[model samples]
Target: MTDAAAPTPSNVVFVGAVATASVLLSAALACATPFAALAALSVIALPRPQALLAVGTAWLLNQIVGFGLLGYPADVVTLGWGLAIGGAALLAVPAADMAGRQAPVARTLAGLLGAFAAYEAALALAALALPGSAGAYAPAVVVRLFLINLATLAAALALRALAETLVHRHARAA
Candidate 1:
């Protein structure tokens, strides 16, 4: 049997849109792609398996855009950092899912914060093992990253809401 349940059409669309957006974001922001925001949104809006798929798609697309389009160094250290980011993104999914379950009223915000914390923590741990990585963890850098994630999450939510409203209006018209 397959490990994941069949994805709904909306889930497929969500994953595709998020992954595409992530690739574009990575092209612009490189290492500062808002993975925590994507992960949190996925977990908050989808089932566990679909959430994993969404986050994984975003991470994979970011890596492709980074290495293929953006010309990231094809070195061991760079590859290690990519893997670390993927791992952190994956970790954020579960953290956000758990927080969303616990706080229904503020599920989205709680999930976003939880996912960001987990993602940063995982990256910090990875930095300890990778030379020259600790500099990225400086307070100023972390704050900037957090702001990026927060803004991305807010924008994603707004876009999703707008999309839903448009779809509903179209359905009514039809």
Candidate 2:
């Protein structure tokens, strides 16, 4: 029988430290912002199902923390905002996937703009129908919200493109 090699103490310590650091870093990054964490998932080239899982997990965690630690009303607002942002992102994915084959820059930009416009239109109509304060029904708010949502959609699309690039590069290298 061959002699079994014993694990070195230094190697064990190094592995432990690395594992701990990774956990801490992941937690910190996820806590930073939903977008950043979602972008990180893209960077890692997670499959669609895995990507959705990450988004859903983060969303649920945010809901719990926002509701339990923060006030209930704030949590409700946060939940609404989270749902809106996530729904927009989800809607953009299909368009982006379809546009990925064409000229990268033009297609990506067009897809993002299209998705943003669609989401903004939906939001605008919903907001218009809501019975609330007149301030909430302001035209300026609608315009600003549209712009912000568009910017966010564009950013997410850009991140997705970058991730696809990295994935391609990795595949070529391998």
Candidate 3:
């Protein structure tokens, strides 16, 4: 048999555990901030299942933190945010996957930017769905999300690059 050379299951578990902790901690932080969970940003670079896992757990933890521990009102605005952020995860993940396959830097950047746009669109749709929450989208809120998403996209891309570099280095060393 060709000797197995890839990471073992235990390695996967270790990585997964670390990633989960990171996501959950980020989600906890998100509960206090104007930004969505940074977990949502990381999902852009992950595969679909992992993306779902990361974002879903983060969302759940965020709700627990915001509603359970902090006593944030479970109002339509809050609910709209949760749903909209989930929708944004769904909308942006595909763009991140596409970015992996895209060759040109321009195409990759476009894909990431498209993810940001998709997130905004999804958030808008969610707000519109809530009867009174649409008015909450004041200019300041819009600008803040726009800026946050910009930073999120940049961080996600940087993390992806770092992962790739590490993988490449490992391969070369092997």
Candidate 4:
């Protein structure tokens, strides 16, 4: 009879621990900053639709969790906010992907600005729909959302840069 090799205990334990840590860390970070978490979840590095869908699913799941745990309002409100924010974020993805084609600085800037505006507009519309929301609050919320979008954009850029650097390092090593 041929002998069968048993799985190593250490290997199993290591895999389990890594998986647990990854889940926990992702949940924590997503809750802290949904935008950045979603951006990180994107699979722009992969040139496959399946990868993009998987990444988007992860991002969507994270957003759901955050909305459930955080101070997000009803389902309608959450959905509206998500659609707006997500749509805006999506616009940047194409610009980012096209960055290597030509002079991308201006395009990236424009994309980010457009995204910020879209998010802000959506947020403002949502606020306006809410009962007891003051007219003056619209401006304040717009500013707040703009700032948040900026922060999200910055985080996305930094993460992308880090990912690129790691990829380049790996390529060089190979």
Candidate 5:
């Protein structure tokens, strides 16, 4: 959160708003990998417990939609993928805080790269640790993820700006 956003009470209003925002944004921009953005949004808008709640819920919902409704295959890699996305989102807090202290573009880029890297690293570790992986990190998969990361982060940044603007506007109106 911002420097001025001291830890507020865990009231329902803001928490609900954050949850709704996360769900809507994640669904609307599913292709852009909104998990990272949701995590950063949590750090920016909510406190620690609430951040976890927001990101955790968003991640769960994403999984439900991705595998349940979208017909994604169930497999070991899919399980690992869930953990990776959640990890990326949860790990985005520090990056978001660091980026919050910088200019807008820097902030977004830092959040994007930093959070995605965390995901990539975690996934790599999972692959290394998993029984069937055999240490084979596919080059094509990496390339695809790199592209997804770039696009997702850009969309996330745009979403961040829109959310920040809305927050400011609401504050001003009050």
Candidate 6:
């Protein structure tokens, strides 16, 4: 676990990218912000404190986009769901971290799956309390959301790898 208050330059970039991507994803996917994917990436690519910060920043940006720009309802039910989603995203960081620790070779995949499971479980629990949310948990809906998260994770990982490769090549040339 890295120091919670200290953020390395790379970590700052990672968190900023995640936060910006969250807003973009919210615009493109509506309610699907890919928190699980972000959580998994954060845990796998960052120190523990940075991972938490990354996911939390993403969640906060999503909410801002949702309520501020997207005009989500201001009612209690809507607020409850928002809170639930934020809580789930926060929970996913530790879930991914714990699972990734257990799987050395396939840590990213393990983290992704662990984060997704935790994210869904948290939302399911919320659905039980909030009305009209059960539909979001339908089998087909769940599968679609899972696929979205999986794709997000794959693309993010690819981008990170590409960036690292470019940086290394540039350093070698220099």
Report every candidate's CA lDDT.
0.87, 0.45, 0.56, 0.45, 0.62, 0.88
When sorted by lDDT, best at the front, the candidate numbers are: 6, 1, 5, 3, 4, 2
* Highest-lDDT candidate: 6
Candidate 1 TM-score versus the reference: 0.93
Q: Which parts of model 2 are misplaced by more than 4 Å?
A: 1-51, 54-86, 128-174
Q: After superposing candidate 5, which stretches have Cα over 4 Å from the reference? A: 1-32, 73-77, 131-147, 156-174
lDDT of 2 by residue, 1-174 (tens): 122233345434433432343243334433223232232322233334443444444445554554554433564444566565456444434433444445656654555455445545544454454433246437796555445444544555665579679989999999
lDDT string, candidate 4, 68-104, tens digits: 6554666775566566445534443443344333344
Worst ten in a row by lDDT for model 2: 34-43
lDDT of 4 at 2: 21
Better candidate number, 1 or 3, judged by lDDT: 1
Q: Please rank every candidate by TM-score, starting with the best.
A: 1, 6, 5, 3, 4, 2
lDDT of 3 at 42: 39
lDDT of 5: 0.62
Regarding TM-score, does 2 or 5 come out ahead?
5
Clash count for each candidate, listed in order shown: 0, 0, 0, 0, 0, 0
Candidate 1 structure quality by residue, lDDT tens digits, 57-165: 8999999998999898999999999999999999999988877346654888888888999999999899889866757878999999999998998888889889999
For candidate 3, give the lDDT of residue 76: 74
Error of 3 at 126 (Å): 1.9
**Worst ten-residue run, lDDT, model 3?**
31-40
After TM-score superposition, the amount by which residue 98's alpha carbon in candidate 3 deviates from its true location, in angstroms, is 3.9
Clash pairs, model 4 backbone: none
Stretches of candidate 4 exceeding 4 Å from the true structure = 1-59, 71-102, 132-140
Task: Mark the regions of model 3 whose C-alpha exceeds 4 Å error after superposition.
Answer: 1-45, 75-77, 103-108, 131-140, 156-174
For candidate 6, the per-residue lDDT at 63 reads 83
lDDT digits (tens) for residues 1-174 of candidate 6: 346557878878888999888989988887888999999988877887888888888888888888999999989998899899999999999988887455554888888888999999999999889986757878999999999999999898889889999999999999
